[model samples]
Target: MPERPILVFDVNETLLDLDALRPAFDRIFDDPGAMRLWFANLVTYSEALTLSGAYVPFTDIGGAVLRMLAATRDITISDADGAELTERFGSMPPHPEVPAALRRLRDHGFRLFTLTNNTLEVSERQLERAGVIDLFERRFSVETVRRHKPAPEVYQGVAAALEADPGDICMIACHVWDTIGAAAAGWQSALILREGNAPLDVGPQPDYIGQDLDAVADRLIERYGGRGPDRGRTMPPLLD
Candidate 1:
């Protein structure tokens, strides 16, 4: 079997696309470029919060991004638009290949879960909106871990919750830092190819790097026979 027998996914860019908010952001800022800058700042501050030993819901992060963008661009956005964009984050759509790939992984006897820096409600609602809520057995949020990706504890916590050894868990992410952290923690890595994402050099790099989840799934199946001790393991937290 492939080294990492358990598979955990990073939710946002790795699977879901928050592009639904592009139009929303455009309307607020009167410029499409504003959305990119806003998201960049959102990720920046999130990492800052984790490094500073503080945690905030992704909802707060959304608002913070809006404020940051407005100030930086010298534009004003109405409160209604702010609320709409905040809510828009939850309604992100899963990537085109995600649902099918997730189903294949389940059918092939792989355990699946999500590990995201987004808050629980935000993550859950995103999955539900994408119509793939059944794909992930559990949605793990940093809100509980009080840390974010690239933190050993964030990745380790997922392994702990699933009762899997770090070496036996694979983290699928598009972020180089996330894969680097997982590799450092002994987990297998899969880089779900996405625009503007980078790769890491740790320990021989990711075991699989694919343009999408389906391609990654194919590589995993090829590496590991996919049939396992539990061909029919029960859905985890979702079932509980």
Candidate 2:
């Protein structure tokens, strides 16, 4: 059997709760759904910039997308409003089960890391605020490679940094596009079906799917826990 894979995670919406920013969206756009729209547009434009051979910082893209969204409704956003949005984004909390699930995976002997489109500074603040920063061995930002998620280069960059083969990593993320990219890079992947995300029927797909990090952790432990360097022993029960 193959050795257990190192776990590489996506931060936003995968580990952290994006809904934490909804209040800012509601106040800024006066629309309950504006946060989702702004996020979708942020991803879209980020990918567009990457594909077109232009690179912009993720936070800058986020701010630009917020402005674009505001313009759509002829709503004016002040500098203070933009700053508040940025602050809120960086302080999102982990999903309720994320901390324990992450600790469980670490306890099972799976090395953990993070790869995010957010800049290292932003991601550091995010995970630190969420109280799980200590769980990750390393955190990678696509900013280092001047690319974004769903880009093969970004995935490859992570493998290169870790000095591991792509096949040695298993990416866990909430977005299908992310898993698709990791799969293309020859990494196994698990998709967490966060409320707003669902698996796609076409193209490369994740090897596993679960409704939450806890569920995904269970699957990972079942499949690979006994296959780590200290092999052939039954895994311990998951943490409560």
Candidate 3:
């Protein structure tokens, strides 16, 4: 079992596959790429609001962004169809390697938790749908803190919630911004390089990088497993 620091995962696009929503986008917008656009815009605007000291529920932001995207393209979508976009967000499946990797990490005895820019309700449903709810000790959302990620409050809030020093948490996610945010907040971080995702050239580099969840788990177990819970640690930054 790895000693010290909680493994804090980002739910969307990290454990749950956002690409699975492509078919919904295709059905609604007739453009498979619409899912990609909607997600990118959602993240972009969410951060924009956070930086401006504004706040909104993550799901509300998601639905609003969908409408805005439709407007930009002169695409009129009914309210029901708009709701469907985010209604399905909480039921995405895990990526192919997610379940096994989660089990591997759990069996290694590291504490596991999720920190997301989502509501607690949605995060729970998403994990449940993915069938990995039992693998996590808790699910955290920035909504409780009323802040979205990349903001220092979100990461610090997780550390506070876990009753651990910020350095005693490892943030694992596929988004460079998410890892960078954790790093800046003084937590260890891993970048899971899912396809169509890449680390940003700016900010502190992640402590580990991998092709998938399984690859990330391999490195975590190798580095931190079997230390009998006394592996007092460092905040060394991993280079890109």
Candidate 4:
């Protein structure tokens, strides 16, 4: 059997339950659906900033997006409201199956890591709060490259840091744009069909697609488990 590829996970909605922030949104925007809009805009702007050669911290962009959204509806967001959103975002609980699924992947000898748009500090706080921080061997942030996902440079930077061939890495994310970016970088990809996400037809597609982390974990273990030698090896340091 071919050596199993290293698995690199995406944080945010892929592992953590983004819905945990709904209450904050409902209270602040007076519209629960506004959460989705805010998140969508946050992501859109992150990419836009990267494409335009401007970089901003993801959390700052999120805050800016929130204020922008509030302005659109002529609503007011106070300092406390912004703080509450930040707190909720940082403390989002892992999806119901996330912890176990991650453990299972590790048990199957997969080397797990994270590459997120959030800064390393925020991603650490988030995974630590989610109680799954230990599952990852390392967490990478786009801040290191000052670029965001769907930017080939972001994916390439991870591969360069790991000293691994792009083909030896698999990117697992709920966002199709993320998967597409990794695939373009010659990495394998898996897409978890989180709510408001689905497979896209007109692009490089993910190698695996599942309803959630559990389903994706099962598929990975089935495909890559029990190989003759352990291919899921320890990773090198991100910096020399």
Candidate 5:
């Protein structure tokens, strides 16, 4: 049997529904699509900053990107609107079925952790708001390592922090770049293909892929739950 790997989750968009922030965008720009544009720009700039060897908190990049996106479209946003959007993002709820899926994995003996590009304070606030904070044993952030994810150091640092071999850690995320990065770093990866996300053809494919967190959790439990010394144990049925 392959090693029973520790599960490291990506916080934003993977487990949480970023759609929750759409209303804020709608109120500001009269276009819900602004949230999507803002998010994409935030990620692009964050990665660019990382490659340039500069580090900023994810939320700060998010705010900067929101303004840049507004400028591109000639939409003026109030300071209160921007601040409200930032606050709403930090308290977005988990995607449907995520909480139960996490509990199922935890109950089946897998150790769970979060590896997010967000700072520790924001990660904690988001998870706490999502009501799944207790399901994780530890929450990791690239801020500690002074880099954002898809950067090899972020993945390696997560494994190092958990005291687990890179190969014995599984990075679960909705972003193809994240999965590809983890795979390249020698960690197992599961890609959750949530709507508006898909796999890329460019690099090593993820070891596992699913439509949502529940689907991925089912696969993980089936493959790793009752293996090894627990071979005789019966795994529980997946939650609906």
Candidate 6:
């Protein structure tokens, strides 16, 4: 267990896998890469809105992704299909290994919280579907900040809510830029190596990297020791 608190997550891509929407997107757009492009554009535009000092709800990002997919593929995306894709988003299940890993961390006395750009209702429904509702002590949504991932203010809000310093919270995720934002905000970070996510190239490499959350929990036990809580040491940027 960490002697100090450690908030450990990013919800959408990190906890809930929305890639379940991929085939649905392909069906609607007649393009296999439709989901990929939609997700990419969603991240890009969300960041653009935040940087320009405009506030948009996270669900609005979904609508924008749907619209972009329609235009790029020259296919008419029906309102029914668009709602289905997001309904898939709301109905996501956790990765196979997440529940056990989070359980081990909690058993070892590590405080847990989740931070994400997902709206409250969406996240709650997804977590309920996955049956991981008991895992997090708190769930911090970016709805409060009206911004997306990789934003320092959003990360800062998460830290503030826990009364935990930025450095004490470790941002764990499958996305490079999400951890980059956490690091920029002075948080410890890790990459949960997942299929299709390329390795990160951030200046400060994540403090830990693992094949899955279970591997992450094992490494956590190693670094901090399972028998007793330990204060953090500055983890050097990962470089090979």
Write the residue-wise lDDT of candidate 3 on 2-95 in tens digits.
Answer: 3556899999999988887787789878886788888889999999999999999888898889889988889988977866766678788999
Query: Per-residue lDDT for 17-100 in model 4, tens only?
Result: 999999989888788689999999999999999999999999999999999999999998899998888999999999999999
lDDT for each candidate structure: 0.81, 0.91, 0.87, 0.92, 0.88, 0.79
Model 6 per-residue lDDT tens digits across residues 151-214: 8889888878778778888888888878888889999988888766766664767888888888
Candidate 4, residue 232: Cα displacement in angstroms equals 16
Residue 51 of model 5, lDDT score: 98
Q: Candidate 3 vs candidate 6: which has greater TM-score?
A: 3
Q: Each model's TM-score, in the order given?
A: 0.87, 0.93, 0.90, 0.93, 0.92, 0.89
Candidate 2, superposed: residue stretches over 4 Å from native: 227-240
TM-score of 4: 0.93
Any idea what lDDT model 3 has?
0.87
* Global CA lDDT computed for model 5: 0.88
lDDT for residue 83 in candidate 4, whole number 0-100: 87
Query: Which of 2 and 6 is the better model by lDDT?
Result: 2
Compose the digit string of candidate 5's lDDT tens values, residues 135-185: 999999999889888999999888778788899999999998899889989
Ranking by lDDT: 4, 2, 5, 3, 1, 6
Q: Each candidate's root-mean-square deviation in Å?
A: 5.7, 3.1, 6.8, 6.5, 3.2, 7.0
